[model samples]
Target: MNTSDLKTKIQNLYQDILINLDIEKIDDYFAENYVQETDHDTLNLNEFKDHLQKLKDVVKSLSIEKFNDMLIDEQQRSIFLRYDVAVEKVDNSMGNIEVYAIFKFNEVGKVISCRELSKAYHEELEGLANI
Candidate 1:
């Protein structure tokens, strides 16, 4: 896929799949052997789907506030994005987070693997003393 197309797909993956919590459409974007790595754990496609399902059940609302940066390297078949996200739970508590995600796409343009690192609002202030 071209860089533009790859960028669009990455954006849609977040907006249409993650923000919308459309578990049924996961296959449309991810390869059958998709792998996801996070700070704590790594998951295959099925496990990742289950994680999304759990998030859908627990979080009342989710939004990607800004896609701050996107870089596509066609030669490496990789895409990177830095984004801000906001989530609100059923209890009305909310948090904003910043995330950096890297995706590797298959030849046909499906995401074969993804690695994400995120920092919550509070996590960014770990060394601060006064509130």
Candidate 2:
């Protein structure tokens, strides 16, 4: 795939699947044999689906604030993204997080694997440090 196509797919995967918590559409973006690593955890396709399901159960809402950067390597069929997102928990607590992910696509252009890292903080807590 070209750079634009890869970028769009990644964005759609984030907004459509992750933010929307649409587990049903997971297959549209991932290959049957998919794997993902986040921090110290590793998950296969089923495990990833379960993780999203759990998130859906606890998260009231999720929104992407902005995409900080995106780098595509057509030769390697991989892309890296850095973005910020906001999530509201079931109890209505809000968390802002920055995410960095590298995705590798299979021969057929489906996402085959990913490695990701994220850090969270409360935007409302920023002013407390100065008080």
Query: Each candidate's root-mean-square deviation in Å?
Result: 5.1, 5.5
State the lDDT of candidate 1 residue by residue for 1-131, as single tens digits: 88898888888888778789899999999999999887646889998888888777667888886788988999888998988778776667777767788999999999999898877785532211111
Each candidate structure's TM-score, on Cα atoms with residue i matched to residue i, is 0.89, 0.90
lDDT of 2: 0.82
Give candidate 1's error at residue 26 in angstroms.
0.3
lDDT of each: 0.80, 0.82
Least accurate stretch of 10 residues (summed lDDT) in model 2? Answer: 122-131
For residues 11-49, what per-residue lDDT tens digits would candidate 2 score against the true structure?
Answer: 899887878989999999999999988875788999888
- For model 2, state the Cα shift of residue 91 in Å: 0.3
